[model samples]
Target: MQDFLLHGILAISAIHMAHCNPDKREKYATISARHQNIALSQFSPGLTEIGENNADAYVLHAICIFLVNTYSIANPQGPITSRDVAQSFILLQGIRSILALPFAHRYIFNGPLARWLYQGSVEPAVGGNYSSKIDDLLNLTRSMAPSDDTLTCQSALEGLKHTFAAVSTPQHRKGLVWRWAVSLPQSFLELMSQNHPMALVILMYYAALVYAFERNMWYLTGWGSNVASALDKAIQEPWREWIQWPLRCIREGVDIRQVEPLKPVEGNPRTQLPTINFNLGLFKPSEPPP
Candidate 1:
């Protein structure tokens, strides 16, 4: 557990050094990887022993492991494929595995997670409450005939929306994106890994959400474009149409708010919703959305 925590800090410092201390980048990355391997060695055995004394540590370890793997794939030096992005979703499912233990409820309410769970009011979404883009995209899953797949897709979309709203205030960066992945079920994760058309469509929005607030993040830089391009190429018609806005945003490397909205129907008199202008400077780079 301590190794996991130590490796996490080192991995984070390595990312920090990419911008703050480029000369020290390789040195920290090397040491971080060595410590991470030691942490990995204990992961399997640790899984079986997640009792009261170890539950908190185990959950933290899950988060650290996911971030480390995601960082490796999202590194700008490498190419990011739809398959590579899928690995991030799979790593997130590992967190679900830990939480499914019999003592899950206790872990959330009685452990280190409580403060976060009971955290105060959440920030609103862009365009106030989910934007029309989200409404249009979600219609595909929301209207699906009820089934395991429908339920899973619904759950994943809901999670994506929750993350979309949570990150809209612009102060959010990095790890907040993990919330969407963590909320998914194993079935949805498999769909994403296989690059299913509908699942990829959902992922396009996930990419847009990342771009919306945190495209500047170290581990997430260019993720929006990489994910959008991969999915845009992989998905066929009808479903492909669902991804245009995000694809364009990624292609242009512009913020979502910077993209012009779709024009309203000729006969439609519904006024376009006004967007709130958030003060990005209100919070430091390390703070949550203001």
Candidate 2:
């Protein structure tokens, strides 16, 4: 397992070096290929062993998989292929399953690996400006769904809040956004699969968050905008209004709050919801909304 992890890390480094110095691409290409082969050989047995009794090892293994996927999709040699996206989703789903285990939280919270993978507490900042927005979204979602689905909705909303907080923070931490991208609870994916309005709204908001990182990170180029565009097209009327602000923000490369707030319609539940805002600064090179 340790050997696989080491190879995964080395593969990531080689890929990054290749990205930075095209002249050495052939050298790094050879290095990345060798490390990737070794990691792939041990991947299955390593995961099986970790699954037996070591939650820490399991999470570490997941991170290594994430790093490898990051390198593949971000490689400048070509456009991101459909296979790359599919593979990332598969690996991310695997991580989510490991996290679902009862002991997973302990490893994520206090384990030595926590410093690298965990994003602090799940608790949102109380009384923070964005808290109100998240709360409103949660409340609205609960109102839309059955009581049994409330937990799922709340969990998804909280995940969105976490993503917002991570992206809003000043630094560009690679794992932060990637964690959110992959770690979303299974319930969230189910809601998305069903095309639930609340779910689409939450996803659109996340898309906007992704857009904010577009200019700054090589790995994230076009990802944010692509997600926003896809969601905007996927969501239909009434709900379309819910995502308009985010879509507009991404299109204009401005913060969502900077877009003109949507007007509330009398007797319309959607319009009554407050505009979502992130107090965190926008990704660099973005102009203030007009």
Candidate 3:
């Protein structure tokens, strides 16, 4: 398991060197590809039969996969396609699957990893100044006329508001914002996969969050402007109105602390966030799996 993590770290380091060390860039880039391939090859098999003991390994492997791909897609000259953002979130969701493993909390509380284990505990805020912005997007989804995709779109947006609320507090962790996708349904992932306009709009919000928090990262650079630009082209006329703020954020780099979070829609339980229990603070059972 550590071997996979080591390969992933090496791959990421080499890519950084490739970009920064121009003279040896080609050599470093080639080394990165080689290590990335090996790490990913190890990851694909690990996903199939995840158990308590192996769950930690899966989580580490997924992080490697996520970082490797994010770096691979980054291009100072190229656009960050909607597919890139969508695929990144998809990889993020893979981390949640590991937490869902039975009795996961035992491992969840490990030192340094504890915050991630319990981050799901925070719910979307009720009636905050910035929450109205999230509300507007929800209303826009409703105004567009209800469809099967509505709930998934709403859910994805709702998750964003929840994340906004989480990050607003002093307890916020560095990678915590990425957890917004952890609650997404397969249906929502499908919508993003389809490049549906509404889904793309939600992705724009994600782009803003990443831009606000992660723009300094080499792989994450330009994600904001590129995602906004791609969405600008991918989304048609009327839909443009809903994405204004995200575009503004991409253009102006708005402080996320001041942004409105989306409140759960009144009377809509589906939009309401509940405390997510990853089974933290539990002891591993003495008996092994049968």
Candidate 4:
């Protein structure tokens, strides 16, 4: 399954590269359909459970995570000295993905795990909750060992922390609180509002983990005297200050008071409504022609 996902993404990337014009490198570089679909679908409330078998969501989720992991492994940004170690870690994650697909949809989809295999089966055309789809994929990924290596562990941890942050249930809050403490302020959070707050939150979560990963890589490359001192410096005020500046500016510019809060609609029993509309131009209603 993991191999299939990797091949699919590579194939798509190759096609995009071949067909795309040289002037369109920037556009093609941003061809992250998998990530976009996951984000857009998840934020929609109407897509909670849309298919007869709910297989579409499962496959989409699986493939996206698989690609993310594959991309991270193939194009590592840090610590290339241990190529063998990194390759083994990637292989480990691949194996875990292949094995976990069976249990991934078992609880929610409630059917044979084999039904969603990558051998030849394709899902139906029903739409799905992108967030929920990725949530399941993240959960499957989380079941794997987190102590694989600094890089692998960092990647896995970041993925799990971000994806689960989407679902705002009581159980998930505990995890969020833990994650929030370590996550530094991020610029992306400024773009998010109540409607899609999870996107901002999740991005920051991974950003924080990556910050830590990069700090460690600094020590590995002998930038600092040793790993301990580098890690200590990473957690110190300098790093925190650097991240805080941009986030603080964004926070100041965005006016929260202007955005009306969600509330129950007046005189409507069935629906929870937004804040009252305050259009000033209309004359007040005069008792409706009694």
lDDT of 4 by residue, 1-290 (tens): 33334443543463245233546533543454433343434423323333434443434533343333333322333422222222222323332333334444344345454443322311221223323333443464466466333233334335444433422333332223223222222222222222122332233333332322232231111211121222222343423432232122222321111221233122211111111111111111111111
Which candidate, 2 or 3, would have the higher TM-score against the true structure? 3
| Of candidates 4 and 3, the better by TM-score | 3
Best by TM-score: 3
lDDT of 1: 0.60
| Per-model lDDT | 0.60, 0.57, 0.65, 0.31
For candidate 2, lDDT tens digit of each residue in 1-290? Answer: 46767786787677667667768767876787788677667666555454434676656656655655554443323343332343455566676666655566555566676566656554444454345666778877767747646677778778777766665565636556655656555555656756666776776677666656566765455555555554666677877766766666666666542344344222111101111111111011111222
Report per-prediction Cα RMSD to one decimal. Answer: 11.1, 11.9, 10.1, 22.9
Q: By the TM-score metric, which is better: model 1 or model 2? A: 1
Q: Which stretches of candidate 4 lie over 4 Å from their true place?
A: 1-25, 33-52, 77-290
In model 4, what is the error at residue 221, expressed in angstroms? 23
TM-scores for all candidates? Answer: 0.72, 0.62, 0.79, 0.23
Best by lDDT: 3
Where does candidate 3 have its weakest 10-residue lDDT segment?
268-277
The count of residue-pair clashes in candidate 2 stands at 0
